[model samples]
Target: MPTQNQSLLDALNACVAACEHCATACLQEDDVKMMVGCIRLDRDCADICALTARFVARDSAHAQHLLKECAEICKACGDECEKHGAHMQHCQECAVACRRCEEACRAGLAA
Candidate 1:
């Protein structure tokens, strides 16, 4: 293992990938209308994750602030995904990925 911080970085990367994939999946669903909210949230969460990952990767001074915002976005996306989780496996996966990102963001905030 590269160590815990490295593991977190890896997880954050995974979350970003998950968010992007989920957004694409939402767009592909037969009932586009049903996934409107999910896709919107997925885009937002993915953007946040990408931005936050950049900050963390550079070990930026503003990482704390960015991570805080990332946590908030993740929470909102997670809640939205939870709503459609029963029917959409992608949404459920997104919810899990959002939670993971939230935890990683929070840890970054505390660092």
Candidate 2:
């Protein structure tokens, strides 16, 4: 991994972890039905982040494209997570992580 890409990599990893945790926690919530969208977005965000991290780490030719897609997914996930942030600690944490990852992805694209 390039030295400059380290921050992006870190953000991707953190987002993946946060999304997975949020998804699991959402599944356990009493109102699981209402959390379906959040859980789905969390899972999607985690998958994209993980894949993007791999591409970025290897300096793949498609990294830029993945970064764009990752940013979009992260933004969506963050928005969804933010909806439940006031009542759910997991969602709050996930929202923060997703926002950071989204910023990192945008930065990576700019670079």
Top candidate by TM-score: 2
Considering only N, C-alpha and C atoms within 3 Å, which residue pairs clash in candidate 2?
A: none
Against the true structure, candidate 1 reaches a TM-score of 0.89
lDDT of 2 at 104: 97
Which candidate's lDDT is highest?
Answer: 2
**Worst lDDT 10-window in candidate 1:** 1-10
Least well predicted 10-residue stretch by lDDT in candidate 2: 1-10
Which residue pairs of candidate 1 clash? none
For candidate 1, write residues 2-111 as lDDT tens digits: 36557567667777787788889888889989888878888888887788778777777887888898889889989998998899898898899889888877876776
lDDT for model 1 comes to 0.82
Candidate 1: deviation at residue 52, Å?
1.0
> What is the TM-score (0 to 1) of candidate 2?
0.98
What CA root-mean-square deviation does each model show from the true structure?
1.8, 0.6
Estimated TM-score for each candidate: 0.89, 0.98
Per-residue lDDT over 1-111 for candidate 2, one digit per residue giving the tens place of the 0 to 100 score: 576699999999999999999999999999999999999999999999999999999999999999999999999999999999999999999999999999999999999
Candidate 2 lDDT score relative to the true structure:
0.98
lDDT (CA) for every model shown?
Answer: 0.82, 0.98
